[model samples]
Target: PVVSDFKILKNAGVQEKESFHPLRWFSLEQNYPNPFNPTTTIRFKLPNRERVWLAVYNSLGEQIRTLTLNTLNGGTHTIVWDGTNDIGKRVQSGLFFFRLQTKEGALQRKMVLLR
Candidate 1:
């Protein structure tokens, strides 16, 4: 026979039990205006408070710039990317990617830049 570990609470002759469920976190979007000339926005959401880092990279996997890095509360947030590098220098027109890393998982989406 198998035994399960569970506890019951009684308050004034009433009994109560508790249960648990798993949570799943995810990001919901790809940026618009890809192949943009100047700027574009990236949006995502979190299910709980977590440390997050958002960055942009070139096709070669080299990080171009960091858009955000901090602990954020559960909700939606957006970041704008101006076609530039970490040094504030304008980048060339080509394929790029926006990446998000959090306690749950990592995600990446492709974008483009145009002169």
Candidate 2:
């Protein structure tokens, strides 16, 4: 039988509740501790498993670091930026942008770093 309304019934006595698979689309959340010192965390959600390309860019729109370039499972995931580049060199304090790209599309957000 087809299940409509994006839900299913449990036991006869139990009431219907929202499903656990709540994520329906791709999303990128802002980094915590906006003006972080040593590190910051980035979070994102995926509706399905797909290849992800996440990177951080400078104010000049130049790529500074490629955080991830691999397939991630469907669900919420987290990444941490340690104020360093791909070469493991520390970056200066400034505004930066991070982009999360997937097969569905792309999402971008800005963050700040404090020395």
Candidate 3:
């Protein structure tokens, strides 16, 4: 005769790993003064440490300038786009887009440049 030992594992209903911080939806606020003159402020927030990239693009989906490109901490941050290209050349007044991308996700906002 052989004796068998069986053990049931409990607490299986309990979670083990820590849950993520409430996903603070990242946002791209509208550039102040719809038709910004010389400069404008762009704002965004990060819920955790992530590689952030903030750039400006023309209506044609062309990258105009890169405002931020580095590892950032979890917090709110802002950058100013002076309505210029990568070479410091002022762009023509038209519709533009401010894009933000991170490990979390990506967000895009529309802006206007007024000469």
Candidate topping TM-score: 2
Quote model 3's TM-score: 0.76
Give lDDT tens digits, candidate 2, residues 1-115. 5556467558758588977856789999999989899999999999889999999999999999999999999989999999999999999999999999998889999999999
In candidate 3, list every pair of residues with a backbone clash: none
Worst 10 residues of 1 by lDDT: 1-10
Better of 1 and 2 by TM-score: 2
> For residues 15-65, what per-residue lDDT tens digits would candidate 1 score against the true structure?
667766334576847887776889998999988888999999999999999
Looking at model 1, residue 108 earns an lDDT score of 92
Question: What lDDT does model 1 reach?
Answer: 0.87
Count of backbone clashes, every candidate in sequence: 0, 0, 0
Across 1-115, the per-residue lDDT of candidate 3 in tens digits comes to: 2335655678757767987666476666777767799999988888777889999999999999999999988788878888889999999999999899887678898999889
Q: lDDT for model 2, on a 0 to 1 scale?
A: 0.94
Off by over 4 Å in 3: 1-23
lDDT of candidates 1 onward, in order: 0.87, 0.94, 0.86
Instruction: Specify the poorest-scoring 10-residue window by lDDT in model 2.
Output: 1-10
**Candidate 2 lDDT for residue 102:** 93
Q: State each model's C-alpha RMSD to the native.
A: 8.8, 8.1, 7.6
Candidate 3, residue 52: Cα displacement in angstroms equals 0.5
TM-score of each: 0.77, 0.82, 0.76
- Backbone clash total, candidate 2: 0
